[model samples]
Each structure stands twice: as C-alpha cells, then as structure tokens.
Target: MNSPTMHLPHDDHDCGWYGALPSPAPAKRLSGQQQADYAVIGAGFAGLAAARRLAEQKPGARIVLIDAQRVGYGASGRNSGFVIDLPHKMALEHPDPAHKQRLLGLNRAAIDQLQGLVQQHQIDCQWSHAGKYQGAVGPRGLAYLEHFERLMTELGEPFRSVEGDELANVIGTRHYSRAVYTPGCYLMQPAALVRGLADSLPKNVELLEQSPILGLKRDSKGQWLLQGSDGQVRTPSLLLGTSIFTQEFGYLRSRLLPVMTFASWTRPLSQAEMVAIGIQPDWGLTPADHAGTTVRMTQDNRLIIRNTYKHVPRYGKSVNEATREEIRAGHRKALLARYPQLAGVPFTHTWGGVYAISRNFTNFFGELETGVYATACDNGVGAAWGTISGALLADLAVGAESRHLQDIQAVTGMPSRNPPEPLLGLGVRTRIRMAAWNSRSEL
Candidate 1:
C-alpha cells in the first residue's frame, strides 16, 4: 500500500508576508533508518505542539517530527492568522452552556500558552491583540448577529455592537450594515508564527522536512515503521497531526471531509491609498454569515481576502489552473464589493489551503489503532483548536492527566461517519455552492 503523503500543488503561491521573511536553513532530509521513542507526522501547529510537549515530558527520549514541506508551508502558514479565544460560529450552533464554557476555556488556554511562548521567545510574527469584528451585510446576516449577541449574553462574554457611522469607524467600510466587536482574538503573520514555533522546539526533538511518508505499518515488535521517500523511522508511539490528509492513514476516513479554501493578498497599500480606503490600519473581520468571506488588513497595510471554498476530496490533485483562476476572480469580486474605493488593487499572491471538516463539526481526538493517536478535524478553528488538541494529545501519550485533557476528550469524542464517496462529493459541493449563494452579499 502507498504510504499516505500530503501533496501541495506546484502552482500554489504564498503572500508577501511569507516571502518577505528570511528562509530557515535548508531542510535535512531523512535518508536512512532512524529510531525514535515517539514520532509526529506533519509540522503544522498541532504537530509542533505535540512534539514540544512530548520532548518536555520525555527529556531523554528521541522524538521525530516530519512534514512533507517546510515547517510553515502548509495550512498552518497559509491561514489568515486568527487566534480566536472564543467559540465563534460552529460552537454557536450547538450551544450547550457547559460545553460552550469548556470550549471557550480551552480556546483561551491555547491563546495564553501561545502568548507566553511569543513573549518568552520573542517570536515576531506581528502578533497583536487587536480583536475582531463580525460584520453583517443584510437582514439575514443581521439576524445571525442577533443570535450571536444572545449567545454572548448568555455566556456573559463582552461585546460591542456597532452600526452605520460606528461601523465605518471600526473598519472604514460602509459595506457592512452592522458589526459585533469582540475583544479576544489575536492576529499575526501565520507563516512567521509557525516558523518561530518550529525553530523553538526542544533539543531532543528532531525535525525532518520535505520528506513525505510512503507507508506506515506495525512491526513484529509492535513498533510502528514509517517509510518515507528516502528513509524509515521506527517508533513505539506515533501522533497523526497531518491535517486533512489524516484520512489517508485510514483513521477518520469515513468522517473527514477535506475542503480547500483560497486566499488572495494584495500588495502593500501606499500611505495615500490607505487614507483613501478609510479603514483602520490593521483589522480582521469575519462575516456574520458563516459562509461569507473573511477579511484582514495586515500590519503592513496589505489586504487579505479569503473566500471561495471547494470540496477537494483529494486535496489539490483535481484543482486545475482554471479552478484557481476562477477562485481568484471570485476573490477579486468579493474584495471589490467591500472596498470599491480600492478598485484595481492587484493581488500579489493567491493560494489554496486544505482544512478538514467533520459531519458533526467536532474534532477526531483519540487513540486510533493501538499505539497510534489521531488528533485533527478542527472544523474551521485551526489555530487555537489545533494547539490545544496537540498539547492534550501529548499529555495523553505520556499517561498524564488534566482537566483540560478531559474537556477536550469529552468535546471531541469521535467524528460522525461521512456519506459514501460520490454522494459525499456531490453533497459537499452542493452545500458549498448554496452557502456561497446565500452569503453573496457578505462575500
């Protein structure tokens, strides 16, 4: 059987935020037989967190972490860095008071951990506690915001509702009729943050990049032998943090749905253009409509627009140049709809990132097969959810116990099974199209 691997499209590109940073030293590929006490596949947020926690717990044990690409080249880096501290859209749907509180606490814990790390290590990813705005474009979106306010009120979370001139003051865009300003989300340069985290991993953890795994099986001694393109690793314990590709491991195959989302970043805006745009220097806006576009004005004045979701069952193998161009055109239209003043503002980069969604919108977190543990399917809250889940998974691996771990396990018991293949694909595509249509104004 072919070893599961993550394949990034050759034509996919990153924004200037990533390209402007200095490259890390060249990757050291795995080329020979190696052994480790624990192994982590995928060096994104979750994998990095798992490796770090494991290394800290087992000071003398060898921990191997591998990624198909560079540390920050995947979804971890490609995301529009929003480290949310509250349960946003998905959590709002199933609002069991206790469960929501548990999730909120977990998310805040993740943010605290991340904040401490950034302060201690001085990981300069343009980290900011600038909060975020959930903007509404029409009556439907307004009703959604009203429901969000009710939930927030029940949870006693602080939020400010802004509209008309107040909304313009917050985002400088009159496109939104109203908005809810919540002060808990942190914004950052995603690629830089992931790179810093990877670089700061403990000494005992070995990081191998650009080495995709080809196969994985249990040896006669009950150890896992993971075969890579040019090498193999034998470990008694393994953690699968490989994002949407975790399906390839035969773990959450029936429950994991891979969705690819596109993002476009414009070139830095001139001082005059910034004035003309009439928005805050740096702001992040999530649409009140869950399916709507997400917008961010970077610290450096670049506009980041993310929208257009595709049901990419096989990651990007089926994503052609035409599809990419179509996505770009959609992004441009969305950008224009919100900020027509910045007409003709060219996007410097356009890229696609894969995120896993489950049938129940919960994560898959538990032991899959004997010594193999799987933790993924974050719905859409990748940054905070991935971090906390990884840390808790590490705690589980070492036989440690904590209330946080219990909360996570309780919340993400198991993913519900997905529909069979062709039907699953059809259903997901139809849902996405319908959602995009419903959120056209917000987009």
Candidate 2:
C-alpha cells in the first residue's frame, strides 16, 4: 500500500469556547528540519497528556507536539466542558461490577491529575466541582432518569432527586419535569484548559501549532518521517492522539465512525435578564436521554445549548451552509422552548465538532505498529477518558506499570469493525434520526 497523506482539520466555523477567550499569541509554525526523540500528533487532551507524560518520564529527551490548528481550536476546545468522574448509564449498568469499578477509577484518576495540574499552574479556566444534573422532560426521558437513579443506588453512589420547584430553583428552568443531581462531575472552559495544558508543557517538550503533518513514511532506520508544509520531523517513536483523523494516517479506517454534533452560545445576559429568569449559581445539565440536549449556564453568565448529531463521514469537511443554518435553528428552538422569557436573545456563536465512536463503544488504545502508538475513538467522553488514555499510552510506550495503567488497559479495546461505507453511513443516520425523534420532548 502507498503511504497515506493526512487530511487536516478544517476550521468550518469559530468555536465559541475558543472565540470567547482573549486572542492567543501568534502560532509558532513548523519551519526547517526538526528531530525529536518522541513526536506526538494532535494537540487535544490525549495528545497534550501523552506529550507531557513522555517529557516527564524522559526528562533529557526531546519531545514535539504538533497540531493542525491553534491549540484548543479543534475538537478539544469545542467540547461541552464536563469532566465526568463516573461512568455513563450504559457503563454504570454493566453486568460485571469490576468492569464498572475500573471505568470509575480511570475517570476519577483523570480528574485528580487535572486538578493537581490546575492548582500547581494556577490556570484560570474557571474549573469547578459544580457536579452535574440529568434532567427529564417527558415519559421517555423520565424513564431514563429512573434507570440512572437505580444504577446509582445499586452502586451506592450518592445522588439527590429533585423535581417541581426544586428542579426549577436549581437550574432556573422549568422545561425539565425532574432531575437527578450527582456531585462528582467538574465543569470548566474547555478551550482555556486545553490551551493552558499546552502552554505549561515541561521544558523538554516543544509545541508546534498550525503544523499539520502532510505526509508520513518510514525511514531506512525504521523511524517515522513526518512531512509538514514548511518542514520535516524525524522521530524514533510517534504517538497519535488524532482521534478519528487516525484513519488518514493509515490506521483504524474501518473501526471508527465519525459523527458531528453542533452547539450554540448566547451572549452574556444583562443583570436584569439574569434576575428575570431567577438565575441561581452557574450550573450545567445533561438530558436523561442520549439524544437530548445539553444545557449550561457558564460562570461568565452565557448560556450554551448543545444537541443534534449528523453522520458527516467526511469529518465535517462537507458540512455546508444549509446544515449549519439548520443546526442553529434547532438550537434557537430548544432555547426558546426552555426559556421563552429569553426570546430574542441572540446566539453569539454557533459551531460544530466531530467525535469518533466505535461500534462496541470501546476506545482504541495501545500500539498500532512498532514505534507507533495511538488512543482514539473516545465515544463522546473525551475530556476525561482521553486525558488518562494519553498518559497511559506514554507509560505503555516506556514499559512503565501502575494501577491506573492497568485499569485503563482493562477497559480499553480495539474498536470493532464498522460496516462498509454506504451501509455504515445509512445505519448511523437511521439510528441517529430515530433517536432524535424519540427524544424530541427532551430537546
């Protein structure tokens, strides 16, 4: 087979999480020739963690972390910033108690590491242990909430059930009929957190933004040769945190499904508007149903509404103006349905992000070939899972062992193969549409 060239991430629209922040310093693009003991691609949570861990483990070695765009301008910065500590409903209800425990352990470990970094570096991303609320609108959503409650009880996890006036008092929204509050999740400004992570890298690690690898091949010495537009990097070991884009690098082509989800953020509300809604302290809520919307009142007093999914197999390169407008319309409708009082409040920014999911909902981690490693297919919880997986990938590469590494390995697996293209696209679209329709009330 011929060497595979990379198809880089295109910035279709501005990410609100990134745009809301002050402009960053000019990006340091790759130039001339470069050599590193280790090269990590994709500057998201996974890549950042992997590169940092490698530098920490091998303090005297050179490590390079490269990104196609500015750090945090891609999916990592575009996510709905929830650092979840517990498994989601599906994993929580797994038949094997040990499997559930391992997942929980991995997630919490990710959070703990991030917390230490935030404090040590004094990164001001508004990191908060604000917990999370799962809200329900109608019967279907309520049923999901009930199931979640049962799982929490079975696991002896502490949670509170709130409804009626209590629910409204908590989130300042009456759209949800009931909610379950779990006090383990943390919320933050994703873009800021990711950028901080990149900036705070150890002295031995070099961060090169806007330096997409245009082509890749193996050299006579069995080292990876990465060709950028303006330069080349030769490294003995290469790590990929590129997520679905890993397919373009000649790996995981048939095992990962790339899906795009959209989000919109409102301009900061005026003090009067805040009073009008009887706003409480900042909070975040996810729908009980998988297809339902995610809502957040940020610490900065802006509202975010994220929902709707599309099977953009082209990895968002084909997302046209029509689809963008349609998603914005959906966001507007959802916002009004929940807060009719805030009608006419305009959305300051709207954008879409792509995430990869495996057929069996497992992550892809470990070595792809000699001197090459990857962690991808995060299945929607990349913030926490991606961080720990990246760190452990470095540990695995260095032949290090620990309880955290073992836990991540136990839960990680090779992504199951997806159906061929046309069939895969059809199946995914059908399932997503049916799910959205079923959860229409929650949306």
Candidate 3:
C-alpha cells in the first residue's frame, strides 16, 4: 500500500491518531466491483460523522464508507487538534447572511456535539473545554482585537477585553497588549478521536480504509458507482467526504482546489515546563491578530501551534526546504513575537495538510450528478466546520430540510468559476504575496 510519493515526515500522523495498532486500509485495494445502498467516500471526520448519523436516521441503510488512505489520515489526522469554535479563516465568496448565521450557529452547536461524542463513544482523545482567548500581541494587532471585543459586546455576548496582568495570565506573554477571552471553545486530540469514532461505529455501517476512489459514475439502473482499485460499489446514494482529495477523483478534482495549512507540536512538556512557558491555562486556546499564529495546549501538555501558510502554492507534491523554512520561520516569528518567553522552545514535529477550498468557500453538499454528493471546504477551519458541515449534509440527505442546508445549497447553486488549474496556481500566489502585507484577501 506504500507509494513512492509518500513523505517521510508525514508518517508522524500515525503516532498520534492511528495509535500503535495498524489501522484498516481502504477497501482492500478496491478489488473488482461491489454494491451498496449508500457509499460514503473518505473515512475521515466528515464521511464518518455523516455515515454515523445516516445509520441512526435510516437503520440498515447499507452504507459503505471508503477512504483513499487509511482512516484518520489526511487533515483529520494531521491537524493541530484545537477545536476552536471560530477558527482562523477568510472567505473567497460571501454566502447569504442568513446562511452565514446558520453556519455560525451550527459551528457553535458542533463544539458541544464533539464533546458529547468523545465521551459517549468512550474515546480517549483528551477533551477539554477550558475556553479560548482571541487577542493581540502588539499594537499592530491590538486594533483587530478591539474590533472583535466591540462586536461581541454589541451582540450582547459577555466578552471583556483584558490587558496588563490579565493578558499576561491568559497568554503568558508580555508582548500582547490586548485580549478577548471567550468561554466555550475546547481542545481535542484529533487522531485519537478519529480512531475512536471509527471503532465505535455500528455494525450496519461498513468502514473501509485504503480505498482510494479513482472514479465516480452510474450503472445501468442509474445508481451511484464508486470505483477504486479492483472493487466497484454501486449504491443508491453516495457521499464524497474526500475533502482536499477531490482533485484526485474525476470531475471533483478540478471542482475544488487545495489550500495548505501548517502546524508544529512540541514534545509533551512537563508541568514545570508548561507553567514556565505560560501554557498553564488548563483548557485554553489562543487566536492572535490577523496573519497571526494560533496556539493551544493539548491534554498531554503539548503546545500545538498552527497558522495559515501564505498561499502561493507551487504545482505538484514537492515540499521544498526553502519554502518550508520560510513558512516555519513565519510561524516561529509570530509565536516568539507573541510569547517572547518561549522563543527557545524546540518543536519536535512540524507538518502540513491541504484544505479543500472551493471558489465560494461553501462546498457542494447537495446532490451532485445523480446520488453523489460532496461536503468539504471549511475554508481553513474544518475541525468544527467538518462536524457542522456533516451534520447539515446528513439532514439534507435524510429529507429533514432545514434553513441551514437550504442557505448553503442556494450559495453553491450560484454561478461559480472553478478556475482552471493554471489560474488556481496564480490566484494562490497572489494570495501569498498579499498575505505578506497582512491583507484580508488570503482568508
């Protein structure tokens, strides 16, 4: 199942999410052909979550969920594990306000659902609801924080801006001059959660790993066809939860584009180290100003720092050291600039993953050709968005119509330019350059 294209360092994902056990691969190389009532592609969070919900709604639905790689691989396994209610993101095209509000509400609801699932499923993925801090580390960023604080207060949300000692206690950084702490966000171990969810699925729902979906088509009766390797599955309905992998599966490849985000996690820090480094806020998350680094402490005492890599993506799969250094340096600089006290802390692991960003920021959740559907493009914030997106998708598929899904459906139906591969490359480059200047264009 190995490929010449696999990156050596990328294997670090196995250590955290897939656990010590060798997780199942995708559908045994898709041998020959198969049949089902429902075929869900990509066994990560979106697909798995949708499959679980579907089984609950339609008992014995004959669902077959497939993944290109093993379960918990891709962004689900490689993320920084912070479940920020509102993650770092920007929109390519704005959807309706009502839809935006619904998405926001769904996002808030998912935070609670994720916590409940982790517990109900008995997943050992350390979960904490210590809340989150969205603030500024310098005057340049302070204005942004002030705007958020004002907006929250105007909305009648109980948020208070802090400075001086309060700011120091929250972030352990003397560099930050302002802050807005929101109580509700949580931190999670993404990989562990993925495995636990997959392991806890009901017997009726089949989970297949290493099943790279090579093609999507229809049979003589017009049912959905998910073909991969040597196996083919004909299902009455199919959900493409492949997210960033859409580019590899037929028309979907160009239908959605990929955006890369980077993360670095330090080796588990001791209590003393945690306190010394100002990560002592038991269940806290941090989102500094725009173009700023996001930091959060995991249940294991590891400080997980993540940030958007200024786009300007190069073609192909190569990860250049020069670009890596540049991106990593940007992250480290942002971190040190915020927490000057932790400048010397060593990062044991650094990684990146593709975020499937569609032109409209909204993904294709409704029926695509025939029974096939897709739920992806959380922009760059899929942790919470994935849960919300999947739940909404499940509702839509089940005929349980809601304003939330309707809003998103309308947005996707709007005219969209998929931007050919050549244009996508250029747009991303322009994004990165504008990103250097801290414009809102790259969000």
The top-ranked prediction according to TM-score is 2
**Candidates' RMSD to native:** 1.7, 1.3, 4.5
Q: Which ten residues in a row have the lowest lDDT in candidate 2?
A: 1-10
Worst 10 residues of 3 by lDDT: 1-10
Off by more than 4 A, model 3: 1-32, 86-97, 251-255, 281-288, 308-316, 335-344, 402-415, 439-443
- Between candidates 1 and 3, the one scoring higher on TM-score is 1
User: Per-residue CA lDDT of candidate 2, range 209-311, in tens?
Assistant: 9988887789999889998999999998999999988988888888988888899999998888888897765788999998999999898889999999988
Write the candidate numbers in order of decreasing lDDT: 2, 1, 3
> Over the full model, what C-alpha lDDT does candidate 1 score relative to the true structure?
0.86
Model 1 misplacement above 4 A: 1-11
Global lDDT scores for all candidate models: 0.86, 0.89, 0.64
> What lDDT tens digits, residue by residue, belong to model 3 across residues 1-443?
12223222122342333342354543445666677777787777788878887888789677777776666666787776667664343431133344445555666777777888888877877777766777565565767676666555544456666778866765566665667777757777777778778888877788777766666666688887776766788888877676655444544545556666677665677778667766564455455555666676666666666776534233125456676667667667666665676667877666677666666555566665556667866666677877767766777777877766665575444224567767777886677666656732111
Show model 2 residue runs off by greater than 4 Å: 1-6
